[model samples]
Target: MTLKELLSPVKALKTLSFATESLILTWKEIASLFGLNQDIYTNPLHKPLAKPVTAILIGAGHRGNIYADYAFIRPDEVKMVGIADPNAVRNGRFARKHDLPAENRFYNWEDVFKREKFADAVIIATPDNLHFEPCIKALEMGYDVLLEKPAAPTEEQCRIILETAKRTGRIVSVCHVLRYSPYFRQLKQILEAKTIGEIISVQHLEPIEYVHMTHSYVRGNWRNSKTTSPIILAKSCHDTDILRWLINEPAQHVQCFGGLSWFKAANAPEGSTERCIDGCAVEGECPFSALQIYYRDKKRLYVFDLPDDTRKWNKIILRNLKKTNYGKCVYRMDNDQPDHLTVNMQFDKNITASFSMEAFTSYEGRCTRIMGTKGDIVGNMETYTVTDFKTGRETSWSLKTDYHGGGDHRLMQDWVQAVGHQNAQILSSTIDVSVESHLMAFAAEKSRLNKTIEPVILGV
Candidate 1:
């Protein structure tokens, strides 16, 4: 068996923080389900079972580097064939680090797809605004795709991408990595089976944490709601997607109330300026050094082992902060995108959801509660538990996922395996379920802007 298939229940179960008995039961269940207990074997896949699927990573920024690691998980099923980015420096550095062939690396995505049109699939890890064009083109090129989340920024784009997938007979899967988490999948299965009995309401709070808010919104590319559409699309797309997935219904209406409540120039602690190091007395006290921290961070990922030149790092980091719709000063990086926002959504079948994104928290894992006719379920992502309503018990099943960048690897693996199936419905046929989640975000934004409850729409 492959290392993944043969993973001991004890080992996998250990990642979660469930009560001892619950942990053991979960492990036993997984083992029994796969019959791993009966068919105990060693190194069934000393070699990878699937041949490497050649792929071109369309975005060479942060996420582009991540998808490259799929080759590490199942090297036989994937290979890094190329990278595409508009910036020559980022493109070159990413190509060198991931060992993408020099000839395969292209500065523009269209150049690769138009002139060569190579690879079994393309991974569109590009920025939110750029997703639709490449996705439509990738499908047209007859290549299956792994498109990153907030699939597209607008409802129109979402519809277009989904429509093309339907027309072209190609695969398009979004990076809803949380769905593949063994922890969540188990919880969801139990909930759907009515271990939670007719889930009626879902309460979800995404503790974006001040640090994460700063990383993606303040200092990174996602700070601008105008550019990326609030913390909802930029960061909480996963959380929103999780809510939609948990309930398994179309959210018919949405109303949210919140704003850039923290991290603003007006709220800047007494005497703090626009810059972190320049004329700021608190630079020494702050852990999130705007200059030194992100300075090293920017290059370490994008330029590691490639160049001695520090200029590119400076340029990217400075550009990101200057354009920060989130904030500029380290003490005031809480710009826009609502420090705390609450959403109320009603599903078509009368199911209800309450979703919140908060900037201030103990910086822990996500907390989820699903209430149904039969029972209520609650779990912390860090603790990994799902309380049983029937017995008033919560079991431990803390999930194991890439803590740093989310679970892109497993998501990619599932997408590949699904696509490999000959009669795959979603792998190469449909993408509406994923696309609709993004449309919900767009509707949420419209609600936020227009100050009215917006009706959600999903296209087939």
Candidate 2:
């Protein structure tokens, strides 16, 4: 087939299961036929897109804004042409930042599609529950999608998204951004080369720092499991996807055990009030006090839509605390998310993996250890060391971390190229592969709730 025909979605999906080596070879051979340099097709940066790939932002929140920032950083690679957000403050800020025309600024996500396909892709960074609708709608409307993680709140919805992407032949790139990070990419390379011998077992940890747990899971948008999703899927699906990617195999079974260990009403300190701003006796002492986290320290103040006036910062925060969930006592909130959880998974070929998500840590970074027959590897997010069993020699590497270990912007780079070129193979985290991690997460949650070993089933 010609290069153009081979890059089509229907043809690309047929080779989705091909190893990266085989895929690259095929791409190289095909490029030679067209008198194209191999690197031009394989490395997106080597060949620029004919024009910047334009996108419409569906949810101009934290992630949406983060991804859209790439447009400003590299205007020649990608551009933001439209935005849709219900919150006036957020929508207006995003519209102004992107210099979007009045007609392109939408109050509802549905309105963006009401007119016509205006952009090459649509970024769905809406809430966990809002993912499926926008993603399906965008794909059906002939716009590629950059979907935020957790794919959806449930397995059925995730499967539907996967099926729709396959049938519609649209590229649905899930934000498993870590796969694009230098740290994890190097780790995967080591595993792929058998530098550690045959894979035996893996251990991974995600330290969801104490303050972050309180802000996001206990008092913020994802506070309730039903309203959002289980902590495993909401916070640690990235870990699951990383494990699956490193193993290069699907998980066959999963079992986990954990629950609300603390941060419940029963754990409330003596003399604590329902809200931290209510002069609770423990406000000064409590680490989870909204006053301490938001007002005094200004840690997660980004979640609040405070006015631009510098002098009003203190007043705005105080007023926000009094009315919003951010001001509530962590111990008294209706949060059911587990503060700590552990998971054991069995992958194909007798490979085993264990994962832990801890919310009580003072630090936030992934810690990982991989053991094989001939060697082992261990590392924190910044640096990793590998030991050869035969040579008794150790090799270590260190990398700098940016947003999501520098995966955020890198992902945006690859995604824009993929959409601009109409090639899904450029992405490592397309829905077909990414949905496996979601399936693993669902099975883990089921095992946690049912107190039984659960098989990792992929379809609805």
Candidate 3:
């Protein structure tokens, strides 16, 4: 497809134009021609109404890989116009894998936005602190954005990004990929039906609380708060967003307390080296082995996969464990962001929710208890358990999600659909929806420091 045609889904299809009426039949025929009938022709949602888009990916680090996979293969709706990351080596590899033309590959996001003149969209998957600059600039440059979560490091930064999004009239979607999950969507609808009868309060416990946090924030590059934002913002933004979604409450005041308790310098074994492989011992005994485990080959990758999964990380690690150091020694790295954290949020619904985030737990998953005046609902999202207090009955269901709660595929398809019809999902609306969760995260730091509750709204 031509570059301009690649920007708009409705205009990109070579065969089907607006005047054409037999789209389903045309799709079936086209799908049969490529032997992709099963993959493409089955759903009205899957077919591209127009031309596919060409997206420029920024910060091809860990999360960048996920955004790239969805943009390129899963959606089959966006061309990978290019990729830009400060680490040329890393993004360069991505370019090579995607077969992007050399000119399409860039060393910095600014160069791509400034020099290249344009792209249909930009996926800002950089570090938390580095997000605002590229996001604002790219929106102004006319590229719709799909930003990684914890939209910005601070409240002001979050506002800046949101303001620019409005002025530009371009889209900006946060990587709060959970909102797209069927599992969660069902839960939201159930709660909205007053399943528990107006949530009076909520208690959320993220065990090792979502394994990725332990992998990335607790023991990975984002381990230190100084390097990024707090552990809450860096890792638990998804969890925070969940609170907002389930409770339908804007966080008012939040109080949190956490510290680098378990994975500290004092905890390190004397014989162990700063590096993992050169350690004194415990390669087999200790579960947190970095060299023997997590990154023996490549570092941490994204959790979700597209085409029907919330995350592919579990599969990726299991498949490549011997090749990468995924579960090795934890003490060798400069770990810091709190092995545990607790946040108390008072929502506008007048419901108070307490979230407990921990990274050191042996068991990995999420557990939440929601109490209402008339009844209650207790759920273990990882295990798929739901209990109702009103009926005193329990219902159990598990989502067979391959990646991102099996929602990535649907999410990508819809994004293409949105780009096709200009009907973007409200969840990815890129303004307050993105800003609120992050502001709470930044406020959590202050609350922890002052030993008091910091208001999420601060003012409103």
Query: Which candidate gets the maximum TM-score versus the true structure?
Result: 2
Stretch of 10 with least lDDT, candidate 3:
33-42
What is the C-alpha lDDT profile of model 1 across 1-460, one tens digit per residue? 4578438554444334233445424434444432343221121323333567778889877677777777777777787788889888888877776777778878887777766567888889888878888888888988888888778877777888888888987888888877765556655666656666787888888887766666666656676676775677767778777888778878999988777765666656666667764566765565555654555444223322234675565665655545543225744543466677888899968988888888777575678888877666667764454455555454554344322234566566666665555223523113777777777777787787789999887776
Best prediction by lDDT = 2
TM-score of 1: 0.79
Error of 2 at 86 (Å): 1.3
Ranking by lDDT: 2, 1, 3
Give the runs in model 2 whose Cα sits over 4 Å from its true position: 1-46, 307-309, 400-405
lDDT (C-alpha, whole model) for all candidates: 0.68, 0.85, 0.66
Window of ten residues with lowest summed lDDT in model 1 = 38-47
Alpha-carbon shift of residue 230 in model 1 (angstroms): 2.9
Indicate the TM-score of model 2: 0.88
What are the TM-scores, per candidate, against the unseen true structure?
0.79, 0.88, 0.77
lDDT of 3 by residue, 342-447 (tens): 8888889688989988775657657777787766655576433334454444434344431234455555555555555554543333456767787877778789
Q: Which portions of model 1 miss their true places by more than 4 Å?
A: 1-26, 29-51, 87-90, 97-99, 284-335, 384-394, 399-406, 422-430
